[model samples]
Target: MGKITEFSEFAEAVKIANELVAQSAVAISARKMGHRALTVHAKPSASFAPGPSQEKIAAALAPNASLLKEDPLPGPATPIHDAVLARPSRLATPAPKGSQAAKDGIYRGDKLANALYAMCQRGGFSGALIVDDNGLPLAVHQSPVPEEAIGAFAIVLGTALAKAGKLLGQHNAENISIDINYTEKIVLRRFMLGQSPGYLLVICPQEVDERGEVELSIEQIAQILKRA
Candidate 1:
């Protein structure tokens, strides 16, 4: 190749400079148009924060000054016996004086409690609880386990079992029996007391039935409460 002439070199350089200027003008025009489009087409938006809306919802749901005092919901530490003795508010209240339920010998108070204790002793039960359909204890007999705890467990577990039965098309589940064979066997029997929707809950060691004495004690308790 020969050495390029100065005129030819100057001509090539001028051509490149013109091309670059034209391209830069096009780029500047595109950027200006883009900026104009963004400014003109963009819409103002109203943003919402979750905090305010959530606060409003919570305030609306909270109890107001006019709201009345409500009864306690069914849950742990709700004091079952106290609620049972609170008032004659439950529909299954004791039979009126001289009425059929009264004549049938509806047991209550210390007499009923003593009877339950004796029944537990006779059956060698760890604990026993007689509760209404609402899971309120009418009578409880203590042993190694607290009667209140046994009653609560019975209501919750038995209710779950009954619901499970109903879901499987077995409505009005009459009994829920659980036997746990661990270091020591634990047996729990919950059955509907005859006639009423009340329940008779018996918790006893597996050994209690080794001699086959539990069945008789249960039968006696059932017979006694059937009149109630």
Candidate 2:
């Protein structure tokens, strides 16, 4: 009797799936190419801040203020997503000159990553992109962003988001941005001077709302990266 019931359920699901696919095909053909058709709110939030409905849980991406460090035991994942400084077991190398690519008085790629880890810790952000002054990618991790997506974003995307904040104008340019999906995220941020004059690319899990975080974080990080 249980087997018979399971088969019945499977058949019903397949029937619905076929019908939906047929409907979707018709909708696609009628829709404009690259046209986003999602319904918009009557009045999108006037405030520059992301809508209140989309804020991440405060503690989710809270900053790591703990002074105590964790023991670096080898983990299954590679250096890609793991914190480079904190993990002792991995063969992490020192960041070289121009590797960080931040502007004067700003922070480095690692520092930016730490800041983001503090802000959007809810979970979806999985990686980041640390770039240099020239908008070159230095380090990247866990992000689904293709290498091809990097070029246009370097100056154009950075400048556009800067209108949302002051960070973009601080150093004349920023090299990083973030892309957030439902359960995954990537931070494309710039990191500035010290030993490295480039950015730090970070990839992280998507724990917060991607739209809000992506807009705010990119502008801030870009400016900070040039200064770093």
Candidate 3:
């Protein structure tokens, strides 16, 4: 009787445990189904509306169309006036023919000095001097040293060179170069004004074209002398 009682209690306990397990499984299944239903209903659905058409956009901006339009291109530039385009002269008017100024010795001397200055400027000379055959300075321009001394020496050198040329059976030396130092030189140019011989002594670098400058100086001097 005791063994049978023990067996019956064990069977009763197992049946209660089985029923509790089944109830727990059914509760878990119901919770999972509730979670899935809540998830499906909680999410928001995405929806899109159509954008405005081109015609609507144009109508909206019609009020500002004038501001948005580009400015018209500038018209062709006006032609410059002849008087406006003309450059002003800087030179003084010359004295009229046979005028008192033209006849004045002082005026002629000034003109001769101007001619010498122009020659020096054009040939890049350190100085220029015009001397008569008697070794007298007629005009001087931008002289670095004493013009009178240079004039005297130039005449002596020109005479010596002319003598040397005649000895060699050559014409009178028209152009004579004397090297003063390594970088500087003196060019003595012989030219004729009327029947008298004239001298031009120029101090410049050794590399300058002495002959060319001399010829140009001769032409300028001739013009001034003729005018006088």
Candidate 4:
């Protein structure tokens, strides 16, 4: 009886081990099948034959050969409708050659401001202002710095340069430049506005030379002041 019981226990243990081994084998086979399914599904099926030959492709495109020659493939997409093609472009036109005031032969404070604004836009200056000798801003356009502070500083610098030039027995300074940094500088151009000394102060990049713009601005300012 004891031998029979031991034989039975050993047989049961072997059966369990064999069952575990079979389950492990089945799991590995299932994992391999899953990976193969994913790989097979991820790629185009091999059952599909290759594309048409060049001769067949040419035959297919022969009907539209003239169109293909005139306008190649991958050109701009066609507009949805004739109206879409006919619609006027919304792109902004270039700034006018000169200010409206100058063209109309009308000069006023607002017109002067507009002219300055146009000048700054054309010249690409950071800011510009027309100031009196007392350092008061007459017209300002897109002033990057405080108008009053810059106006006052422009007057002070211009006065200092003028005094220095006079002391050396030279002509009064007409243009005074103050370097703010290596990249930017302030330019002061002295002009006479009906017997009153007015200054055109422009802040621009150091490399930009806007002498023509400055001169034009001076002329415009003189005309505006005279008319005012």
Clash total of candidate 4: 0
Question: Who is ahead in TM-score, 3 or 4?
Answer: 3
Enumerate residue pairs that collide in model 3: none
lDDT head-to-head 2 vs 3, winner: 3
> What are the Cα lDDT values of the candidates?
0.46, 0.40, 0.57, 0.59
> TM-scores, in order shown?
0.41, 0.29, 0.52, 0.51
After superposition on all CA atoms, how large is the RMSD of candidate 3? 49.3
Backbone clash numbers for all candidates listed: 0, 55, 0, 0
Writing each residue's lDDT as its tens digit, candidate 1 over 1-228 gives: 455545787779878878998777434443333221111111111111111233332333245411111312224333233322332321224557987647765434334455655655555454456665555566655422333344445566667667767797776455565553321233444555655455666654443442234345456556656654
Number of the predicted model whose TM-score against the real structure is largest: 3
Compared with the true structure, what per-residue lDDT tens digits does model 3 show for residues 1-228?
A: 567546978889878878987777434444343221111111111111122344433433344433123311112232111211232311333556788865672355456667766666566565667767766666665444334445556677778767877797667668788766566677888888788888888866676765776687789887877787
Error of 4 at 165 (Å): 3.4
